[model samples]
Target: MSQFSLSNDNDDSGRLKIHLNSCYLHVKVTRPYIIITMGDQIYQTSISEYPDGRWNEGFEFSVSYHAQLFDTIQLDVYDSYMILPDRHVGRAEIRLIQLQDMPATFTSFYEVWDKKLSTGASSHAVRKTTMATNVGALQATISYRFLHIGDPQQQQQQLQQHDLDRQPMEDDLIFRKHLQQNRDTADILFHKYEEGSHANMDQLHLGTQGHTESRTTSSSSANTMLGSLGSWFGKGTASTSLGHPTDPTTDDLPTDILNDIDSSLKTYPLLDTLGSWTVSKETNQILRAIGKLLAAFGQGFELSNLQMLSGFAVVERFYQELPREQRTWDVVRDLSEIQVASHLWRYSMASYGWKGLNFIGKGNGYLSDAIRHHSDSKSVMEHLSLPPDDLLAYEFRNSGAFRPSYFVAHDPSTHSIVLSIRGTMVRPKLIAYCNRHSIGALYIVGHSLGAATASLLTIMLLDYMDELQKGQSLPFTLQCFGYAPACCVSLDLAEKYKDHIQSIVFADDVVSKLCYGTMMDLKQMIIAGAEAAQNLGISQFLWTGAAGKEKWKSAFEQVAECRQRCIDSMENPRLYVAGKVYQFWLDPTPKNPTRIVVERTSPKRVSSELILKTSIIMDHLPTNFDIAFRRATESMMTEPREQQDGVLDQEDESRTAEQELKHTSKRGGTDGSPMIDEQYTR
Candidate 1:
């Protein structure tokens, strides 16, 4: 019993047991066996009698408990033929840490890959082909455990102390060493530059001395040399001395010598003034023309503004002819602000993969149809609709790298100008066609990277509102909606623009949580979680059944404690969610898997503590956000406003928004949206 006890094994060494179950192969092989290698040790299994590659054999290997984390086990399957040399069929490598992080008894299928061929075949191509062809799979069970050779209680205490001491020591040593290396390199570079500059100056002085000697016969030449020397020593002396005869002038010096003297004097001042320099409008136009010509020569063609305008006209005419019902002013007024914003947010996401006028050539107003179809699929543009003709202008730009795309559309029914910026990906082009241009309330919408852009643009407009409306009779009113925007501004700026901007963050969305402080906290939390799992032996029970859930609960509690410590130690200024935030998440209770909830929370209330949930990333997707919005809207309609608002207000006052979310999904729910309710069951 003592020997079987994982925490009290007689020997300090760790043992790994592997069971060879079976292999499914594409090609038939006779009497197949497997060769297993781990670190310096190797073992071979006996050949199976069945031709289908079944062994049903078990083997054990001893490993140093401390060193086992870095070790990997390699399995090479071979066919033993009487006449031919044993042929290698396939191989698979399994890292020991992977098995250690799983249940005590884990069974899974691993892909088997053929040895690289000598005939210049790409390994990646071969792997892809093998996967595509359903080549082979090896099914096996792996078990691993390690116990310290000491009293259980004392060993646990020591292990905790060691972990606490070792991690920081290692990280600090590495970081300090890297920082020192950088400082040394920078010092070397600076010294080298300084020495080189001095040498160049000395050479210039020598050249001037020689030139002065050669031109000593003329008084004018001497005066010119004196003038050049004075310019180098004093500011603005050359310009002042040019008008006087007694004073030295620059006219007599050779062009090359005079230019060199002028450049040397200008270099330092240029460095100081570089930040203030701006290109004139004419220069920008010239550069734009040059860029256009270069692009035409490189791509063999260019998209002309005339062609874009024609495509826009066709799309506009097609939409105008369609028998679509226009929204009445009363209906538009009845829609909630968030509902309208969510509709515009769809436009933000649709901007990605949008080719603008390029799709018009497909015929029958393909571009307009595509946008309408996308909006219908996402269930957007329903309440206050904007027709294709209302699309005043659209621009997409990609200068060697992907830049965000934007479209300007007018909703005459609501009397609002919509600017939707798309997230990152692909190239962008521009098109514009407007029958009647009229100013209206400005609404800006964007998602992900585009969201950050929209937020900044809103701030700029707010700051320069006076300048923009200098001569205008009516003041401009603008609102911005950012969906899953990155942390783009300071807490001050976010608070300052709260009235005009709103950021919609989905449950456990990682993008919105990103900031210097949050990232640091996340890093610390990961390290702490890993160490806690190992110390508490929680990893061994992972995926085992009901007992695993109990272990995971304990593990999360420990990680939460560690995460709190990390938060207390953080000193960096955390960038909060911009403006008033509306967060959507699923009801955490098991009985309400499809019920989505919304909370209107402040930026400061959003948790900086990173939660390790699968939804952290998936929740950031636009599709997920769309589903969340739809469900949330439905939930809002069904539930009384007062009741729902009371529940949200109570939840906000009781605990953090994220903490409540994490507590509800403590049973390993992957996503916080109803779209993945099936995942909760499994």
Candidate 2:
């Protein structure tokens, strides 16, 4: 009719409709599930087993279509889902078709996300190789391809160190970029010290080129991670999954999501009479989560390590693999800049403009809790996705596969685990994929782009305590943590996220360095000496509490001295590294600006560097037992405690610093606001 046919529009199923657009769609799709709910990208779900029941059913799905004023549009609904009434069980079959003349946007999504991507492979794959490239004016251009590994051990060590090294450098880049993203967010917490934040705040006035990080000899961790490589892309036997898709512009959304909603479970709250829905569902959810934890426990099922409980096998894996030397370069290798940035932007708790279109007032942890919350609520399953028009099903509980964020659920029993982590900036749409696949034990960890997502989500989670206390929502019980990350939030935000996130801080790592200066002006400190250690900007860099700093300092010192004495220490961070990161904060100010001052009654038996290093290296706590590190140290070693009474504790000192910061904020943020550093300003 009207030269438009809905009959052969898609596949044999009556669900397909033809879109009129010019598209060069040559895609080889092995992946069959059409992910219709998340953002624009579609991901291949990794499952441990196939589902006994339909994955999607009774789930309502929809798509927005604009037909010319009087033009007509057809809605085809095929394959259906079936939910077993009153049993907390369901089944689904999605009838999908090969994509052709797909909307330009859909085709682009296909190229980046589907199994069939550029050249041949689906650009959407983590193992995709021979992908297309888009080098914008941004330096994110790929210069190198792959690095050869003589041995796996060497490569693994390189990978871990590589992550560590690039972590700081990349953080610096993001912080700088953050400075440009709406100046309003740059509000200096210089007074940050006033509100429980202490012992840090320093900056490099624009054009101030006083020092440079002397390409610290070859022994640096950054150097170890890098090995000896400077290029656009780091290729280490690039088989495929090119890491992250370069662009979603050419990606395709799987067409499988256009199936019919099951007839039985049409009501909201999803199920009519879920057998013992109250107890079984709750028990099963915990069970499934615990199984995942056991997966994380692996051999550690017997170990009582609290850190290991988090399922860090991936970190162990990263620490186990990767080239070390190339990590020193300015740009760290990634799946794709846009995907990473987009994901970061999309999930940013403080996203701006059109980027966070659907996230209106949504907190970061939405994805993490979406499934569980929906299961417990009247989730009719919103049919809208990115372009905000499409439906798949009205699921009782959306699969973890539908989620674009990361997740890790643990089954406290048996210590089994399941982790769902999206690679790179794409945020891989984990929920839907997790649903399609049986995640034995789920554990998820993401960085940079992933890190920010995690941070924002966690912050919002703690913030949701109000809802939980009011009984509006079930208390989100997933144990989650973020490390060396940035948040689209601040310390004051803690009240909101009090119950949700645990953050890890690495000493001297400038992860959150860009948030402050004069009063939140990001100067970019664009200058020659900007990279040098002598101009350390610790005041603005250290986000971890001073107790954290002190703890790290003590552990590092023990480890450093242990290693120097040729003592065996597996956890000790390399010494040259401790000094480099610590020294990175050289008193740039004329008067010990941002200096982590030290006091001791014992005549300073141990160097502050060693003190800090051992604390981190040995990973000890309650350093008060040792004079060199504790409050009693001053009286025991170099000077008497009474003699150094003027030297305030970390907290006391922070209070004093804030009294000075108020006068500073009046001046302004970064370059435009002031000409001199705070040491000079104060």
Best of the candidates, lDDT: 1
Candidate 2 per-residue lDDT over residues 1-682, each given as its tens digit = 1122322322221122222211122332121222221111112212112221122211111221100101111111112234422211111111121122223112111122222221111111212333453211100000111112344433444344355545757754654354333233222111000000111112212113211122334344243233212111222211111232222311322112211112211233533245235333333344443343233223111222432221122122222222221111121112231122222222222211111222332323333322121211111112111210111111111112222322222223312222323311221222222222232222223333344455454433333233222321333233333333333343334334433443322222233222212000111111101222122234422454666455434433332332233223211111111000111111111222232222111101111112111122222111111211121122224443453334333333444554344455355543111111222111
lDDT of 1 by residue, 1-682 (tens): 0113233333222557778789888878879888876643567878887766677777676554333544456777899998989998877767564554476567888767654421111222223444554348788876665443454543554354455536757854654454345334412110000000101111111112221112233554444445434323322222232232210121223334344333322123453354225432223333443443332222211123443333233222222332211111111111275676666665666454223222212123433433222222112223224443454444332210122345555666456666777532111110011101234367778887678778887875564344333334566567889988887877777888999899987766778877646654454344334433443343443344677556556655555564456556554346777897877655432333355666666676554544444456777767666567676676667755454533322223323334444444555533343334532221
Let me know the TM-score candidate 1 reaches against the reference structure.
0.41
Scored by CA lDDT, what does every candidate get? 0.50, 0.24
Superposition TM-score, candidate 2 onto the true structure: 0.20
